[model samples]
Target: MLEINGLVKHYGDFTLNCTMKVEPGRITGLVGENGAGKSTTFKAVLGLITYDAGDVTLLGKAPSELTEEEKQKIGVTLAESGFSGYLKVKDVVPVLAALYPAFDREKFLGLCRKFGIPMDKYIREFSTGMKAKLKVLAAVTHRAEFLLMDEPTTGLDVMAREGILDLFREYMEEDENRSILISSHISSDLEGLCDDIYMIHNGEIVFHEETDVLLNEYGLIKADEEQYRNLDKEYILRVRRESFGYSCLTDQKQYYLENYPDVVVEKGSLDEVITMIIGGEKL
Candidate 1:
């Protein structure tokens, strides 16, 4: 439902070049470190920032060409910047209803209550998890067709994170055309929730793959210098030398398991894969 081609943004020394697509009915993830351009890409797609180069297609039209009605079809929740913290939950409902014609006040209030947000107090009194929940509630309460969430689960406890993810799953199941693009520092959450993942580092798209392939086929092998030299390096994508041995990442897990039966090979986690891609040496 969204496409970005050769998208480039520059700010003096820092440059961002990203290209990826988010298909309908799937949650796509963008995982990166701080200052890695995840937010920049999101802003460009939402038309909040102008890019130096390339095209961004949101829904069916260019982001800049989207009409107000079309804009309502998309929802966004940033890590920061939202309704005034001084506003009470009761006070914000009217504002939201006024902003979007499809705003479901009943559903919004129900979610707030269900999630244990107090309506009588101002938003400023809520905790970090409460504030995060409020943002997602606002985004989906309008029944948006697409969602762009940046760090939706940051600073949340395990239970809170699970609840928010469940809400996302429910939202997606409610409509066959819905899609979400979520960026988060928490790699495990993305590993579990995303259908596809795009890894970004130093403002570049380093890797993009289906989550199933990544979890099932990707592996990390620990080998010493002698063993590493003897194994087929063709399957090794990146390698980092540790105190004990070499930590290697590979996409050909089954091949390595069959060929190098003595070496220690284990399934790769999202964090391990990202670490190798960003910091380890290439093949």
Candidate 2:
């Protein structure tokens, strides 16, 4: 489990103030645009970067206070860095076995083979999907209880991405105590995998919701200017003007379905919800 309270980081122009928690046995996702501080938050949690304010607790201790043995309980895969493309996939087996006492060589090699990674082929010769799969394989095969993954499925095709996700699901099922905090640009990826979602923008977390609630209860209401004037506004969270009239985002979709039968109400997708929250006029 990981907990971050008031974690703040500042760059020249952007200041990141993030507070989020990843519970045991659950997959939590962070979604935001470029420069939205998803990576900054992950780095702070993993002690890869220094923060200006707040505290971070990882696996029951402050990130800085975790011992060497304690560090082995966590796994990491970053979009920005990892394995040297100069070496073959087989080349890192010994290095990993030497680093982690619990490294499962058999499982690692199995995952690599399952993902179609050529053990004899140099990493540089692999495609983007192969590289991404290799990174995730390395993270999970170490018997780590917690994972901090930044864009593990980036640039991957649909099948490749699903394979990695299935790996995560398998990892969690093997141990209910395990947890994963992942960030992705792909909405469908998060929608399919995350238990809950946190939306961050401009270096701040703006919304958090259970995935079921978000996908099931949330809706967008399309109403013209006349309908908008008469429609109940209590449940509406955001409103945006369209040439057709107004597009409103609401969490209580059932409430409107029962009260106003004429307005067009459509179930909200993750992308539509995020777009509306970031760009629409909040009520």
Candidate 3:
């Protein structure tokens, strides 16, 4: 349960205008390439950065209006910030317990062991993947009802990413009303985990859709010059050049499937959709 409406932020040259929503009991993904305002949006939502304009409501109150206790209810795993490097993994336990009243210290320690995060080692000495797991573990084990995670699975191997995703699933299973808004460049991570997804580019929200609809209804059409000319462009959302001729993106996969039997149509994965939406020419 987070909602952002025309939330505007500006740096020297870059400006981010983002709008998104996370529903109760859902895992919503904010997906985009690097420097695409994913981190900026998160910062604004968490009140770590001041936005130029627009509204941000987190857990039913303005981000800035949220009290310390209210903030404790929202788990955050930010890419740009974390615990002091001098502290050992074990050293943060008491710190977290003091910060979060509902923190499950035993469960946190258990997760560290499960994820191979050495409790005795200095956090600065941990590998990137290890640090990532530690961040995710901190966010999830606190029993926070809402999670705002930016690149939570970064530096993790495929199996590790899956394990972390499974942890999120387990977190939600424990509370039916819990919600998560996560951002990741890994399309498969969002595709497999998110119920709904928002695609961001150049500081703006480009697309938001249900994962099921995106996977099942949206499609890519590979067509030669002749096939392209004959095909209906009504549903074509974007197009790009290809060695063969032209590749088209459409939200109506079944429409083309039934109408153009000769053309090559394939389901649009999240990666393909992003490639077309951000790189291809809009129709």
Candidate 3 per-residue lDDT, tens place, 21-127, comes to: 99999999999999999999998998888988999999999898999999999999988678889999889999999999999999999989888999899998888
Candidate 2 residue spans exceeding 4 A from truth? none
Q: Mind giving the per-residue lDDT tens digits that candidate 1 earns over 200-223? A: 999999999899999999999999
TM-scores for all predictions = 0.97, 0.97, 0.98
How many clashes show up in model 2? 0
Candidate 2, residue 242: Cα displacement in angstroms equals 0.7
RMSD values, in order shown: 1.1, 1.0, 0.8
Error of 1 at 259 (Å): 1.1
**Candidate 1: regions farther than 4 A off:** none
Task: Please report, in order, the local distance difference test score of every candidate based on alpha carbons.
Answer: 0.92, 0.92, 0.93
Candidate number with greatest TM-score? 3
Q: What does candidate 3 score on TM?
A: 0.98
Model 1's alpha-carbon lDDT is 0.92
